[model samples]
Target: MATGWAGDNAVQDQIDATVEDAVKRARSQLNQGPSLTHCEECAAPIPTARRQAVPGVRLCVGCQEVRDQQAAFSGYNRRGSKDSQLR
Candidate 1:
C-alpha cells in the first residue's frame, strides 16, 4: 500500500471524485421548468404520461430510443488506462 508521494487512499479519492463529477454533470443536463409537449427532434406529439413521468421530456419515445442507441460510454478512466493525464 506504499504509494510513495501519494496517500494510501488517493486513488480511491480520485475515483470517487470522478463519479461525483459525472453524476453532477448528468443531473445538470436534466431539463427544468415545463416539459415540452412535442418531440424536439421529430416534431411528434409527446404523450401526457411520458411528459409527467420524465418531468422535462423533450423527445418522443421513438426519437429517444434512437438517441439512446447512438449514445456511447461516458465515464471516468477504466481498464487501467490514462489519457493525457500523466504527460
Candidate 2:
C-alpha cells in the first residue's frame, strides 16, 4: 500500500532496503580480529570488564562516549528532494 505514486511494494521495498543497509553497517563495525587492550583514540587503558563485555572493543568508555555523541549529531537525510526523487 504505497501512499505515493510508487507501486504497492514501494514502501515495503524501502523498508527492506533500510533494514539491509543497517545490517551491512553493523556487520562492517564487527571486529574481525583480536580486541585491543588500549583505547585506539586516546591510548587509555581499556578495562578488562569492558573488553570482556564487548568483544573487539576499540575505545574506552570516555572516548566511546564522545564518538557516540559525534555520531548522534551526524544527521541523515532520508527524504530526497523532488527533483532527485524524480531521477
Which candidate has the top score in TM-score?
Answer: 1
Residues 1-87, candidate 2, lDDT per residue (tens digit)? Answer: 655588879899999999999999999988766679999999999989999888889999999899889888845555678775555
Worst 10 residues of 1 by lDDT: 78-87
RMSD of each: 5.8, 6.2
Task: For model 2, state the Cα shift of residue 74 in Å.
Answer: 2.4
TM-score, prediction 2: 0.65
Taking the tens digit of each residue's C-alpha lDDT, what string does model 1 give over 21-84? 9999999998788889989999999989999999988899999888888785556455555754
Task: Indicate the residue-level lDDT of 3 in model 1.
Answer: 53
**Candidate 1 clash total?**
0
lDDT of each: 0.87, 0.87
Residue 82 miss distance in model 1 (angstroms): 10
